[model samples]
Target chain A: MYFFQKNKYKIMLVASTAVLVVCIIVGSAINRRKAGGASDALGTVFTPLQSGVTGASDSVSGFFNYLTNMKGYEKENEKLREKIASLEDELRKTDNLKSENERLRKMLDLKENEKDYKTVAADVVAFEMDNFSKSYTINKGIKDGITQSCAVITPYGLVGYVSEVGRNWAKVCPIVDSKVSVSASIMRVGNTAIVQGDIGLMEDGLCKMTYVSKETGLEVGDSIETSGSGGVIPAGIYIGKVTEIKNDVTGVSQEAVIKPGVDFSDVNEVMVIKDN
Target chain B: MNYVLSYLTLAVLFVLQTTLGRYIDICGIAPDIIFVYVLCYSMYNYPVRAAVLSIIAGIIVDLYSSTHVGLNALLYMYIGLAVSNFASTLMKKNVWTVALGVVVLSILYHTVVLITQYVIAGHSGFVYPFVRIALPTAVYDGVVSLVLSLWAQWLSMDKIRGL
Candidate 1:
C-alpha cells in the first residue's frame, strides 16, 4: 500500500509499457495467430459498444441522407421503383440459372466451388483510424465460425482475410495493408504472380504484383484473380485490374501495379469464406 | 470525479474515432483522433495518469488495428510520458506549444512506426512511406491537433472553474 501510494503511477506506466512492448514483439513473432486475451477481452466489451454506435451513426446518417434527398424524393422513388422492377426480372432469371447450375453440378458430380463454400456475413463496426494501422473490425467471431486466414471479400472483389479473431469481433487486414499478400494471376495471359501490398501504392488503394516473368505480356487493363496457390484463399476470386507495370527495385522481376476492384474505403459489409 | 469524466470522454471519443473518423479520411489518411486526445490529455495531466490513460486508449486502438497489438500501446505510452514531462517544463497554455507538440510527435510516431516496419518486419524502405504517408499525415495531424487543442481547452474550463 505504501509503495502503491508512493510510485503508483510510475509503476503502472512501466508495467503497462513493458507488457505492451512484449505484446508487440511476441505478437509479431507469432504473426497470424488469433488475437490474444487482451484483444478478446476488449473486443468482447467493445463489440456491442461499436455495434450500437455504428447503428446510431448509420441511422443518423440515413436521416441526413433522407433529408438531403428530400428534394428529389419523387424522382428517387420512381428510379427505385424502376430499379426494383428490373431487379425482380433479373432475380427470376438468376433463380432459373441457379437451378440449372445445381442440376448440372449433380449431373457432372463436380467438386464444390466457391458457391458451395460456407460464409459468414459481417458488418464493419469500426475501422482502424490511425496513421500506422490499416484494418477494420467486423462484428463476427468464433461463435460465427470465423477463423483466422478466412478470406474476406466484397461482392466486387477481395477485401482481405481475417487476421485476429475475437469472440464477437475480428480484425480484417485489407489487401492495401503492407502485411497482406494475395497469390494472383493474369486473367488474360494466365501468368501467375503474387499481389502484395506496397507502402507507396497502398495510399492509392493499389498493390504490387511481383514475380511475373518479363516475357509475360502485360496489359494496362488485364484482370487479376487469386490463383489459389496457398489454398487459404479459394481460386478465381477477382482481385483487381492492372493499372501499371514497373521494374521492381531488385530489377530481377517486373511488378504490376493493380487497382483493386472493390472500393476499399467504402466497404461496409464483407463475406468471410469459411471452410464448412 | 474528474478522472471518471475524463475516461468517459475518452470512451466516447474512442467510439467516434473508430466510426465517424473514417468519414474525414483524406487521400486514405485519416486523422488520428485518439492521438490528438492523448496529446491534449497529456499536456494537462500528470505523467503517470497520462501514461495510464494513453495506454488504455492505445490498447483500445490496437484492438481494432491490423498492425501488431503492442506497437500503438508502446508508442502512446512514451508519447504520454514525454508530452507530460515536456508540458511541465514549457508553457503548456500556448497555441504554439500544442501545435509544435502535435507536429513533432506526429513525425516521431510515424518515423518510429516506419522504423519498426522496416527493421522488425523487414518491410520496404523508409523513403516511400516517409514521402507518401508520413509527411502528409503529420501535417494533417498537426492541423487537427491545433483545432482539437482549442476545443479541449474550452471543454476543460468548467473543471478549471471548479478548481
Candidate 2:
C-alpha cells in the first residue's frame, strides 16, 4: 500500500510538470501573437524610443567621428598631397606618350603613301596565365576582315602574326614563336639581321637577331625595327632594342639579343596590319 | 488549451534556440531545448500521451528548423514512445533518473539532425558520428535538462499539487 501510494504521487508530479511545460509554451506563443497584433501600440511606443535613441547616439558619434576623422583627414591629406604629386608625374608621362605617338604617326603617314600599309585597331583579351608564350587573343577576328598571315603590330613595333581566326576572336603567334622571323634593321649602322623568336630564350623576354656581323656598330640598348622587306611589317616600326650580341667560335653568324618592345602579356591594344 | 500551450512553448523554445541561443554557445554549440523538453515530458507522462505531445513538438521544431516535412515529428514521436516505456521502470518523480531521459533524447535529436543534414548534403563520413556532434549536444542539453527538471520539480511541488 505504501509503495503504491508513492508511485501514484510520482505519477501526479510527472503529469503536473508536463502540464507546466505545455503551459509555458502556449502562454508565450499566445502572448507573442497578441503582441504582434498590437502593432499600433508598438508603433507609437517602440519606434519613437528606438529611433530617438539612435538619432541622438548617431549625432554624438558624428561629432566624435568628425574629430577623429579630421585627424584621419590630415593623414589622408598628406597621402592626397603625395598622390597629387604622382598624378602630376603621370600627366607628364601622358604628354610624352602623345608626342612620341605624333612622331610615329608621321612616320606611318609616310609609309601609308608608299603602299599596301593599312592599320586597324584591335582589343586584346586573355593570355596564358603563367606561360612565356608571348601570345594574346584579340577582339577582332574574321568578321573584321582579319585573316591568317596578317601581321599584328603596335605603334611601337611588330606584335605578332594572326594565327587563328574565329568570327569574334583571333589568336596571334607573336615574334616570340620559335618559327617566327622578322627582318630587323639596326637603325644606327644600317646593319640587317634576321630576328628569330627563340623558345629557349623566351624566359629571359628576348628574341634573337641572327646574321649581324659581330663588328657591327649595334651596341647594347641599340633599337631594332622591321626593314619592311616583302611588305610584312612596314620598315621603321619599332620591333625591339638589341641588348646582347653573341659571337661563337663557329661565328658564321653573330646573334644580337633583342628584347621586344611589347611585353605581349600586358598588351591590351594592337593594330592589325591588314593592308600592309 | 493544453495543446495550445504546448505549441506555444515549442515556438518560444525555438525562438530562444536561434536567437538567445547564439550567445549561450559555450564553444560554438548549444543545447537542443526541444529535445530536452521532449525527453522530460515523454518520461513523466503516459506513453500514449507522450507520443501525441512528441508529434506536436516535432512538427513545431520541423516547421521552425530547415527540416523537411515530417522528419522531426517522426523522430521525436519515436523518442517519446521509447522514453515513456523506459520511464515506466522508475517513479517519474526521481529527478536524477529523469536526467538519463535528457541524455537519451539529446542523442536522438542530434543523430536525427545529423542524418537529415547528411542526406541533404549527400555525403557520409565514417561511422560514430554522435561521438562528435551528438556528444557536445548531449552536454549542452544535460545542463538545460538540470535547470528545467528542477523547475518542473518546483512546479510539481509548489503549485501543481495544490491545483
Clash count, one per candidate: 0, 3
Docking class of 2: incorrect
Candidate 2 lDDT over A1-276, as tens digits, reads 887786964564456446545644554354221112222232233223333343454467568889879878899899999999999999999999979977998987844344556777886543421121345556666668887668888766788787655555566778875547878888988878788776456545578888888678668899888887776666777889888877845776687788899875345578898765
The residue-level lDDT of candidate 2 at A15 comes to: 68
What's the distance in Å from true for residue A2, model 1? 11
**lDDT at A187 for candidate 2?**
90
After superposing candidate 2, which stretches have Cα over 4 Å from the reference? A1-117, A128-132, B1-163
Best by lDDT: 1
> iRMS for model 2?
22.1
Task: For candidate 1, write residues A84-177 as lDDT tens digits.
Answer: 9999999999999999999999999987764677888999998877654568889999999999989999899999888889889988988887
TM-score of chain B of 2: 0.78
Q: Each predicted complex: what DockQ?
A: 0.57, 0.02
Model 1, span B1-163: residue lDDT tens: 6677778888888888788877677877777778888887787766777788888887777666635777787888899898878776665466667877787888888788778765468666787788777878877877887777766665555433212
